[model samples]
Target: MTSAQKPLHSAFGPQTTAQEALAGRDLRGKVAIVTGGHGGIGLETTRVLSNAGATVIVGARDINKAQDKLSTMKNVEVIHLDLADPKSIDQFAADILKSNRALDILINNAGVANPPVIKDARGFDTHFATNHLGHFQLTARLWEALIKSGNSRVITLSSISHMLGPIDLSDLNFTKRPYDKDISYGESKTACSLFAVELDKRGKEHGIRAFAVNPGAILTGLTRHLTDEELAAWGVRRGENSEFISPEGFKSAEQGAATSIWCAVSPLLEGKGGVYCENCDIAAIVPADSKLMTGVREWAIDQTAAEMLWTVSEDLLHIGSIPGLSK
Candidate 1:
C-alpha cells in the first residue's frame, strides 16, 4: 500500500472550516478521541465533531481548563493527558480502554511548536516526544479498541515545516547536536508524517487507516513560543500595534481543523491511507527545488524512513514486544 500523493480534487479548499467539512454529515453513535481538543483548532475540531453527534473525548494536559472549555458541550468528555509524560499517557489509555468503547477516530492533534530546547525525562527531544513519540505509544496501546471499530481513522497533525528539516535518526534526542528550535520542530513534524505512513500500512489489515495533515499556517496557541517580533517576521503580524493579525496564507482555527475533519469522515478517502493531505485532499509530490511549501517532501513520506522510525519509536518507548506492532 504505497502512498499516492496526488490531489483528489476535493470540494473543500483552503478556506473550508471544520464545520463546513462536516456540514451535512451525521456522526451519531461514533466515538472520537481528539488530543489537545480544548485549545485552538483542536477546540474547533471538538465542537464540530460533537455538533455532528459524535461522542468526543477531549484529551488535555490541563483537566480544569479542558472542563471549563468543554463542559457545556453535549457528548463531550474531558480526560487528563500530558503527552510529554509517559505515565499520564498510560493512565489515559487505560481509562479509555476500560470504558469498553470502540474508537472510530483518533486525532493526534496536540503539539508544541518552536519551544525552548528541552528534553523529556527519557532524554528525548521535547517536540519529538510530545508530537510523535507520545502518539506512537498511545496508538499502540489503543490498538485493540481501534481494531474493534471495524473501520477507524487516525489523523496526525503535521505541518509544512516538515519540509525544512532533515531526520537525523542517529541523534533524534539532539544529544550530540546543537539544538535549533525550528529544525527540531520540523523534524518532529516529519516524524508525524512518517508515522502515519507506516502505521497505516501496518494497521490496514485490522481496518485502521492513518493520514498526515498540514493544517496550514493558523494563528493558534501552538505559536506561544514565538515572540511578537518573530510573528512579524513570519508575516503573521505587522506594524507596532502588537495585535495578532492573520497574514495572507493564514487560516482561522476552524479552517485549520478542516483537513483533520475531512480525513476523519469523508467518503472520498475510503480505502485510502498513508497519504499526506492539505486543503482536504491528497497533495501533489513536489520537487526539491519546487519553492512551494504546499506538498509533502519525499523524506516525510518515504516508506523506508517510516519503517525505520517505527522501529526506533518502539525501541525508545520499550514497547517493541507489543502484539502485532513489533518489526
Candidate 2:
C-alpha cells in the first residue's frame, strides 16, 4: 500500500509557514500528540495545531520546562516523556491510553542531534534509540488509540541527510564499525522514512496512514551540539551581536513546521501514505548516486529493508509482536 514517490506539484513550498498551512482548516476535537513540541519548530507546530482547535499533548523530558514553555498556549498540555528511557515512553503511552481518546495525529518529532556516540540504557546508539526506536515503541504502544480514530496519521520527521546513507542492520549501534556522527544521523533519518514504509503497509488497512517528513533545516536545539565552526560550514554565521547570516536554503522555524502539519491535514494526501515528503510535496526517488539535496533515495524507501528494520526494532524494544501487524 505504499504511495508513489512523486510530488503533487503542490501549492506549498519550502517557505510555507505552519500557520499558513492550516489557514482554512478547523480541527476542533482532534487530539494530537507532538513529542518535543515545546521548542523551536515543534513549538510552532504545537502552536499552529492548537490555534486551529486541536487538543495538543506535548511530551517532553523536562516536565517543568515544557510546562513553562507551553504555559501560554491554549488547548495544550505537557506530559512527561523521555524518549531515551523505555520506562518513560511506556508510561507516557499508558497515560494517553487511559483517556480513551482517539488520536488523530501523532508527530514523532522529538529528536537529538548527532552528539558523538551516545547510547541508551540498552547501549543502542542514541540517534537510533531516540529518533527511531523510541518513536516506534511509542507508536506501537498507542496503536489502540490510533486505530480507534479509524483515520489517524503518524508523521515522522526524517531529514534530507538520509541521502548520506542507509541503515546497516548488521551493526546499527556502532558495535562493529567505527562511529561516525554524520552516518549515524543519516541512518537514523533513513530509518524514519523506512518506518513509514512499513507502518503504512501494516496499518493503512486499519486506517492508520504514515508519512515521513523532511522539514528543511532550521536553526534549533538540534544544532546546539555543533561548534561555531561546524555551524559556519552550513552557512550559518552569527555576527558579534548574534544576528544571523543564514544559508540560502535555511528555513525559519515556522516554515520548517509547515510540511509536517500539511502531511497531517492536507486533503491532497487523503489516500496517500508511505512516501518521504519535502517542501510540502511527495518527494521523488533519486538515483543512489545523486548529489542533490532534495528527493528521497531508493534505499530509504526499500520495502524489504523497512520490514527488516521493523522486526529488529521490535526485538530491540523486546515488545515482540505487533498484534495485527506481525506475521
Candidate 3:
C-alpha cells in the first residue's frame, strides 16, 4: 500500500531523441501537463506531445512567453503557474479538477537551477523550495486527478547532480551551513528523483506510476547560473578547434527533452515505474563513478531515503500526516 515497496524498470539510452522516443506512439485524446513548457527541453516536450494529438497544458510562470511559443499548437493551453507559490499551485490544481478529472501525464519539468541565492515565501532556500518542495506539493495536490485518470504517470525532471548530494533535512534551507549553490540544486534534484520512487510505491495500486528523468547535459537557461569560466573548468564546454562533437556530449534542447517525452508517452514503459531514467532509456545502476556524471545514486533511488525525505518534507510544508512515509 506504500510506494516504498514497488519494483522499477528502465527504457532506452541517452542518445535517443524525442522524435525517436515517441515513434509509433499515439496520444490522440490523452491530457497531459508539462511544467515550464515554454522553453528549452520543456518546449520540445510540449511540441512533441501536442503534435502527437495529446492536449497539453503548458504550465508556465510567464503566460505571454508560454503562449508565444505554443501559439500554433491546436490543443495546447498556456496556464500561469509559479511553483514557488503554493497558492498558485492550489489554484491551478483546482482549475484542472474542474475542467477534467483524468490527467494522463504529469511532468514536473519546470525547475530553477542555481538562481542567485534567494528565499521563497516559505523562507526556504530558493533551489530546494522551487525545485523540490514546490513540485512535491503540486504532485500531492494533483494526486486525486492522477488516480482518476487511470494508468497515469508523473515524470519528474531530476539530474545527474543528485549523485553529488544528499538531503540535508536539518539544514534544508542552508541557514547554517556554508551556502554552496550547486550542492543546494543537487540536493533538490535528488529529492525529486526520490519523490518519484516514493510516489510510485504509494500510488501504484491506484494506477499512478512515477518516474524521474535526467535530461543529461544540455545548454539551456538552466545552466545560466554557471559562468563560462566555471563551465570550462568543469570540462563541459567545448574548444573552438574541436571537430566532431563527443558522442557522450551535451544534447540539444530537443534531445534533452527526449527522455521526458518517452517516459510520458512511451508504451514501452507501461506497468513499469519508479526508476531513474536518462538518454531516453532506463539508466543502468552503475557504481558511483565520479568521472561519469550519470545514473541514479544509491541514496537518491533508495526507498528508505525516499520515504524519509517525503515525511520530512510533508512536515516542513505542513501537509497532511504522511502515514507510512516517516523515517
**Candidate RMSDs in order:** 1.5, 1.3, 3.7
- Stretches of candidate 2 off by over 4 Å are 1-3, 241-244
Tens digits of per-residue lDDT, candidate 2, 237-259, equal: 88799766786888999999999
Q: Return the TM-score for each candidate structure.
A: 0.96, 0.97, 0.90
- Candidate numbers sorted by lDDT from highest down: 2, 1, 3
CA lDDT of each prediction against the hidden true structure: 0.90, 0.91, 0.82
Ranking by TM-score: 2, 1, 3
Q: Alpha-carbon error at 311 in model 3, in Å? A: 0.8
Cα lDDT, model 2, residue 33: 98
In Å, residue 255's CA in model 3 sits off its true spot by: 1.1
User: How many backbone clashes are present in model 2?
Assistant: 0
Model 3 misplaced stretches (Cα beyond 4 Å): 1-11, 236-248, 321-327
How far off is residue 286 in model 2, in Å? Answer: 1.2
TM-score, candidate number 2? 0.97
Give one digit per residue, the lDDT tens place, for model 1 in 1-327: 254778999878999988888868999999999999999999999999999999999899999999999988999999899999888999999999999999999999999987675787778899999999999999999998998899999999999998885589999988888988888999999999999999999988889999999999888888777887788788776447655776688898999999999999999999999999999999888775667969877888999999999999988888857665564
Better of 1 and 2 by lDDT: 2
User: Compared with the true structure, what per-residue lDDT tens digits does model 3 show for residues 243-290?
Assistant: 223335778887899999888877767887888888777776656655
